[model samples]
Target: MMHVPPQAADARAKTGIPVLDERLRGGFPRPSTLLLFSDKPTEKRLFGENFAVQGVKAGDTSLYVDFFRAPQLARGELKRFGTIDPSKLVFVDATSSQLLLPSQEKYRISDIGSLTNIREAIVSAIEATAPSRIIVDSMEFLMDRFDKDDVLRLWHELIEAARANRAVICFLFINWTLLEEDLAQIRSMSDFVVEFQSSVRGGIVRNSMRISEMAENGIRTNWIPYAFKDLIGLTVYFPRILVTGPFNAGKSTVVRALAEKAISIDRMGTTVAFDYGNVNITGIEAEIFGTPGQERFEFIFKIFAREVSGVLLVIDATRPEELPRAKQMLDLVGPRIPYVVLANKSDLVGALSTEDIAHRMGLPSDVPVIPTVATESKGVRDALLLLAEMIIGVR
Candidate 1:
């Protein structure tokens, strides 16, 4: 294992995830080391591949060193990240040697059996291309075959090589037989660590990731639920977010402002009985459910609001008199649920300030009271994002 030396704050090699990049204070710091560690066979490599491609999109040549898959297979798998500049993607063909075949790539690991040869091949690529991003698909292959001390020495050399070229290096490793002390050493050596996990239920699989910065005063995030799309690589996911508040607080408008397409049940085109829609923005995907504010439709709120991932409590900022009704509606959904208060109609003359609204509603300081003009789509996305962070348990 290698200790990540301190460097001045500089430009970053983004993770290609807008949500994570923003939280990372503009992505992984340049010339940094990242450890993608998992206990089992999780999709941790996907994040590394995404990070490499993002750098290519930024006009930097990238070096991808794979141990498990051949160059052709690796190229095909990377296409799932969408169209990339194939010319910018350089590969160090390590698999061809095991197959006892001549390689076609610019850099080939001719003698895969020797750790020194592997080191030379990788360092040669880094020094030659001066790539902005480098990824070692899986380190366990070499770790298992070579001496552990020798492998750690190579790890240190690679990190130093990447730093010399001003590149962000990522290593994907799945724990096989490492001891607790060894694992802790690996965690301490890296500048940043991103972990992946998966669970199966009823023939469905859910994936999530957690990020931690190893430096002092660094931020550690909760397990953020995510999914992969056809063209989009990584996106945060939130299912069953409830939108409920007092009647005429413009819940429908809030839903409409947030959702791409929405379906609502209305009586006489007046009071909305229900609203349901899917929202995707800034690399986040969510299913939103809106509930009518009237007491008669209380049954509807009862049906869908209990198991919600989060809540968007919309209230008319101009109609302070309806604050009590809004409080009652919020109470119906129960307490201790992660919710965001949206001061809708904030553009109106009589609209109240976010502070005043929060004070009047007796909300805690940690609870955000965002002012929004749903009709104009103002402040809506911010409120949802804040609520999503809260639901994801971001500290």
Candidate 2:
């Protein structure tokens, strides 16, 4: 008997969601089955498409089996996220007889009615393309067309083929009309299950996700608010990153410096809900969030703390008295997450040194305390760079 060595265990790949990837330890197990379930159109399909595109862009061949959407429409939608090499992405159209031409001649169609023909078409696509990753846009459509047994049989064949070829397979399933037994069967065949749902609370729609069956331990994460940007893709916009201090502190100016463009959601020059900005920094690639220093909007801390990679706790060097509030907010985000303190408005007269600000904030001796003037963008870059390092854990 040939025994496979334990060291040969395949490494999982990240799905690009940092928090989610942490939950999966590394990422989804390669050459394993994954089921994406969502009843409503919560961008679940789009998420799967992007996941496959990421693999293809990384020089791995990928196959997208679309059962509902036309091939051209899918390709067009994917292009909005980023450029995908036409040579790397191949599509199998099980929806239409007419081949919706892709940017290149890499896409093909399978006969919708013939089971044998469909299977052969899939095999040919996989063999010809030699894809490292595969996504079936939906299994629900396949279930609707064939009997449960036939669908299950086809699924088994596909899973076996993917395993033999060392390819990861993602199956998308819409759960509206699916019976519980069918779902159970699908779950049994999958190594990972991701569920997306949307709820309306107080006239506001909120989207959330949960992951189950990702390895030995099932993973869970706090619900983070996200919105789909048409051209840029998904973004998490936290409303505030409170920068508080005594009177004459440079909290307002600090907000402006860190953000690309910011609005002081304050009244009479005092922040209420806090400061808001859609800031993006090069090489770091994250949403920059800031808050007000006032005490009234302390409730917003709970919202901002969720799903945060790291915190940038900014304070004023001129006001040593305001250091307590910065410490208080740091405690709110918990100690496990990395954070840095910024001594803003340092260019002004009588501004405390970086060491004094750190000591006053009760921050760790090694914690970074950057001195800056937010208006001129001085020290802002360093503060953001430190935060990014804390997020990815290099610095």
Candidate 3:
């Protein structure tokens, strides 16, 4: 009997999206095949494009097989993710042949009508460039032209290529024409299947994704809401980080200080509804939703607290009497969800110490109470960083 050492799993390749990377336990294992599928009309290709662009940004070679758009158009869209080094990216343009346009890319699929041409072009590029990542923009082009058996054979070849080169390959598919059995077979071949969908509620469209299957190193399947930002792609994002506390605690001030841009729903110099702001801090991206501190507007907590990643319990340090009301607001956010105390106006005369504030609130010793002067943005970043760490369970 031969004693053979088990091979170590491939190193993770981060997608440049912090939250999504956290969900993948750092990122996807190299050489794995991912099927990014959607049943509804959604921006599924953006996920795959981001995957390739992430590789290129990491100084690894990436091959993008574009079936729907021109190479120039694809390049333009890639700019939304971030600046890229063109030398690191190679394109297999399948669109040029269909449009009868001269392909400017180095690698060209000369004929889209023939499955053999598409397969050969893709395989040759995979072998020639040896990309660390590959993305087939959409399988619709191949599906519309070739038989299922032919496409299946091509799919097998893709898997084999990924295996041979230790590269991750992602196939983007919109599930309108495919039969259930066909979809099942495709899923069976993939190492990970990511299903995404979008819905509009209250005139706001929300998009989310979930890993439906994983053959090994199984994932806890959950629909994680995400959004694409300019120069940052596919964030497993939360649109709200409920910032709440008692009146005159600087909830709105903290939100404004933390956000690059903000809008407050206020009248008569008091927040009547909520303060909304988009925050990108310490590599964690989220929308900060600051609740009105007055007890009368407590009903609005139902609107802002939903799907919040964490809470920032703001209270005026000078007024320790407000600590009880601040603690009460935490109940609205609920238990089990991590939060940090922000003792704002700490620099004011006769302000209570962080220890005194926690004691007054009857919070446990481990509960962090960070002092801040929202007017000057003091301790604001630190408070946000601590809350972010707590939300991701890094603390």
Candidate 4:
């Protein structure tokens, strides 16, 4: 089974995003600064809000300083992130004073013109609450209104305050007009740099985030595609995952094990057309397509192979000779696609070990070869989840 070792509680602050937390070994390091830089603003805020709500759910104080919205409005919008303790989510309202309106939040920015006022308001909130997590949504507003040096000072001050409290702070920013040198400087000050990008393809907007750690031997994860749930927050998402192998490799069995509901087209107990299912796991959802494993049904691969997020290459561990045919099935699916090997029927007497199977198939050392008995549902979920980690570049 796939496993992510747990870290010390004091070492990290959990994001509460299931797949992401698994990869992070809990979450971002405590007493850290994260630069959430994006080309655009709208998409990145989702991640920030999720982080704040997660802190609240984890029983930690969260200080959210908003320069764009009223405290009440921000609080109302945050409800979409699911249930959070009202007392834990404290906000600094920066818009109400500009509109000459009475503020409901404990902290309010009275004068937008004064950089000193904004800095003090935020500093006071941090000092009073001793928050375990902080989010500035966002820095662009001040960056637009103040001098670069003044804004840089405010950024440094907030980081210091968070460090003092052993808190994790994220600064959301859009690259409106900053030079590369300034951007580099900001990145250098941060413990992690999270970059966001969005694109429209076939009329569907796809959002992705990439995280880069600044320490020696720090990790750089691939662009992980994600989507926000109505009230559950951010989740790692994959639209389609394909499963294939040689004849009688239990491709259909593996699909049924991973999916909540499944269907198969078969002839004489042999899948002749295909098997399909929908899988919903903690903070994840995917549609699984299992291709027929016989040479006569090879054309089925082309129909559903194009745009697969990942693949589960299943082979009967007892029949090592069938491994070549299994590789041929993958060849037909195309190349450069992420895949994990399932050594199916591993419980059988003649079954080969995972390492032996990998050597027989000539698979890369990095490719996972997990032992599984799909009919009994053993190691099935782990195989699929490992493939997800591969596709998301977290493993």
Best of the candidates, TM-score: 4
What clash count goes with each model?
A: 0, 6, 0, 0
lDDT of 4: 0.87
> How do the residues 295-372 of candidate 3 rate in per-residue lDDT, one tens digit apiece?
888789877777677899899999877877888888878887779999899998999999888777789877899989
- Which residue pairs in candidate 4 collide? none
Q: Distance from true position, residue 320, model 2, in Å?
A: 6.7
CA lDDT of each prediction against the hidden true structure? 0.87, 0.68, 0.82, 0.87
**Predicted candidate 1 versus true structure: per-residue lDDT over 1-395, tens digit per residue:** 22333445678777777777887778888878999999989988888888888888888778999988899999998888889899899999999999998889989899999999999999998888888889998998988898888888899899999988778899999889888998888888799999999986457788888888899978788788788877668888876799999888999999999998999998886555789899999888998999888888899889887667789999999988889888887787788678999999999997999999998988889999998989999999999999988876663
Better of 2 and 4 by lDDT: 4
Candidates sorted by lDDT, best first: 1, 4, 3, 2
| TM of each candidate vs. truth | 0.90, 0.68, 0.77, 0.92
Residue 218, candidate 4: alpha-carbon lDDT: 87
Q: For candidate 3, give the lDDT.
A: 0.82
Clashes of 1: 0
Model 4 agreement with the true structure over 1-395: per-residue lDDT tens digits: 21222334567787766777777777898889999989775589888999999889888889999888888888899888877789999998899888988877789888889988988898888888888889998898988988999999889998998887778999999989999999989999999999999887669888888889998888788887788888888887777799999889999999999987999999899988889998878777778999987787777787778878899999999998898898888787777899999999999999999989888888889999999999999999999888888887878
Model 3: lowest-lDDT 10 consecutive positions: 1-10
User: By lDDT, is 3 or 4 better?
Assistant: 4
Assess candidate 2 and give its TM-score to the true structure: 0.68
